[model samples]
Target: MPSNPYADLPAERSWRRAVVATPPFALDPTRPGDFRLSRTERIATAGSCFAQHVARVLRESGYTFYVAEPPRLAGSEAEDNFSARYGNIYTTRQLVQLFDRAFGAFTPRLTAWERPDGRFVDPFRPRMEPDGFASPEAVAAARDRHLAQVRTLFETLDTLVFTLGLTEGWRDRHDGAALPLAPGVVGGTWDPAEYGFVNAGVAEMVGDVTRFVDGLRGVNPRARVILTVSPVPLAMTYAERHVLVANAYSKAALRVVADEVAAARPDVFYFPSYEIVTAPTTVGRYFSENLRAVTPAGVAHVMRCFMAHAQEGDRAATAALDIRSEAMRTSQVICDEELLDA
Candidate 1:
């Protein structure tokens, strides 16, 4: 072939050499990232349901897996769930709004949602408290404590790995703040006028993510961000279009947003967890029977790809963690979105 820009590229640049010809388990698609995780770095995680996998693996592999808000109560559900008590943060808008709420820039008017049984759930985290809080006053108190922990997470963590889960979500009509789940699905009554559905476009996703990173660095000057689009598909979609079509657009748009943001920022980088599990080379081996849940094999493959590039060569912390035992616990991940499973 005639020499050209493409001709001179390495074998890894070719689709056939890099993917088609490689064995599924041997495949490693992660590029050289701008940063690597040392065992001492305070690592934190947030984002959609799939993010629970990232959090668990980070903890199991002997990394810092920083949790700013530990379970204050003896038998709290937040043990391996959230860095702060905020449940699944499914959109970039939710992530940005979280920072604003933490720093006192915004306060949502709908602080609590009343369940049918007369209990109230925190609007920010509807599924967090089982049976809901005793009163809105109790909800407010818990939130005050939660946001305080969130502020600490923002200021102290060295790196935050945020998994972008979806572009479709519900938001408040007045302030346009994102809500984790749709009203009535888990708790709260759905009113047409109170809440509005938002399907974020590429520009909106990029803007929100950029705003989040800017807000994060303002508090912690040295904070680094690792952006990854969750490979898991949406459990459901609110759009009139079929769930399949909406999911395709949502993932594609978010992937572009991640690429654009990571490329523009020096300290921010995009990891390819999305690419690894969703790769065609896997031949659908990465998904469970439902075609939505990621199989343990898939999660392990993603972790292997991450360790190959992002983690430092430290086996000391790995000594205490039983990888097989941890794998069994993957089924216990608390995904708020799964409430729509009916």
Candidate 2:
């Protein structure tokens, strides 16, 4: 045998050479590339608020950021950032259930929830409609159209970049339908007897991810997925653990699930947005004053790493693109999770 297994490894294998010795700005965690992306491919994104950054990067880089679902009202920018009008999909359960709902395999009983002001909102997407629907029937009609668009998104999209966001969510006790927000956060009343909190363990998340990959392929076999864990920490937690502790478990569980799914198939791959932003090399400089929002510089660095691995040899990948201007271009990116703190 060799002098030691460690001695034969490259510089990347050494923590000091790979991370500590290198400047934080130069540290790139992404692999050469798991798959290739062309500007002509139809790319869709769905996940928590941080996923918006990925969509923004695609727009800035002149990629065909596909919007499978357009706004019902002309000139309305509500669905500007998301691929679909389903709003922010914060959990794997929500992701899988989305496919199920679109294909007519899963039907939820609790369709519309009444806001305190006598208007109804889709329980799965409470913050989507600020004024709420005129009636539950209107909500149902709108959801039917939304599901059809979601179907098109799954059927025609070439690539999907899904960011895993949360593990803790409230769900129906009877049928296990995933609720994007707790009942009372934005609308409806919190019924303890009817709904319950779920801090999904690793096994459950893995199963959810597997089903999502399998189900997406069922609709479009050529569809490849680029999974990433959102680096944004949880704003609040319903669990008994402290917010910091809860955030750690949530991120760790998601990272594990993304790796598990990505390892199983060549079509699914993991990106390191989580590692790049949260790396020790950065010394927490990526986060803003609140220690929550990722600074524009941090976002640009993440995009740089993304471009390097996406498809190489392009000057635009290394050249300084106007990231701030891109972010400002779609300043209307709406994140439903922000309502959780409200």
Candidate 3:
């Protein structure tokens, strides 16, 4: 046999020799030359509930987890936990529409939804007001203010960490904007003719996200995006197929988009938190009993790997942060989709 270029490569490049051959604790999926974070970088998080974990880790590590709109409530509930109060942004179209609305380029047709008691909720973010706004005028005013803050988030942050949560979402037939949840699920009444389910394919995901990135960079040229897919499976699927089958399709499509988008842009990077938590190699120790929520151990392991490859100064600064007290706080994430379980 002739000696070829593959003769003397690092073991880390070979999955079998590096992962399967080594013990589970030794497995490290991240590679060198990946993007590194600086201690001063302003990182804004949006997307599914899983993104909340990233925000928490950033705060606890002494990194700048940019917050454009602080919560108005008091006590533990006050921490909305993301970069802003714009609840979970599950779809790329929703994120894009948010940018458009902030700049007054696009206005959704279904502005506010009314409840039986006559309270109104913004279609874009229903849960924002648990008791619901007093009227449609109030809903509009609140949404306008929220979008302004979201604009600040887009314009000021150095990095945006967005997690792709679902391929399926509900959208209005009129303006074609994505709604955070199906109308009836949270506040509004169900109007089958007015609302429809969307299972976005790879091309649509690519187009929507690409447009979102372009728009974001147009305002803030220095902003970069870090893409991630939520490893937690869907709480429920409206798709006619079995829940497991629908979930598989949803994740597969989103993962393809993640890979494609990251490859298309140099500034955009994909972090494999999804792979870390869901890989069969981990022996499924990362999931809770319900097999939906990620274990605290899993989150800690992921953050450790992320901080390891970060800038040296950032790593040292993060290490010196007061994490012991915050570590004692419970990890109870507020996910809208989890409502389906109820």
**lDDT ranking from best to worst?**
2, 1, 3
Residue 314, model 2: lDDT of: 67
- Encode model 3's per-residue lDDT on 46-163: one tens digit a residue: 9998888788777767788899988757433425576777788888888888889998999888878987778898888877677898988989899888889988999999999899
- Which has the better TM-score: candidate 1, or candidate 3? 1
Query: By TM-score, how accurate is candidate 1?
Result: 0.94
lDDT string, candidate 2, 1-342, tens digits = 769878878787789899999999999878775767898999999998778778867866778899988755544554566888888899999999999999999999898998888999999877767779999999999899989999999999999999999999989999999999998877878989999999999999999989988989988999999999989899889999899999999999999999999998768989899999999989999897878878777888888888777878766744645656645543465666667787
Q: For residue 54, give model 3's deviation from the true position in Å.
A: 0.6
Model 1 stretches astray by more than 4 angstroms: 72-79, 312-327
Which window of ten consecutive residues has the lowest lDDT sum in model 3? 321-330
Candidate 2 or 1, higher lDDT = 2
Error of 1 at 36 (Å): 0.6
Q: TM per model?
A: 0.94, 0.95, 0.92
lDDT of 1 by residue, 1-342 (tens): 758879878777899998888888878777765568888999999988777877877876777889898854544533465787788889999999999999999998888889888999998888777768999899999999999999999999999999999999998898897899888987788998989999999998899999989888889999999989998898888899999999999999989999999987778988888888889988898888989888887887777667656654545443434447655766777777777876
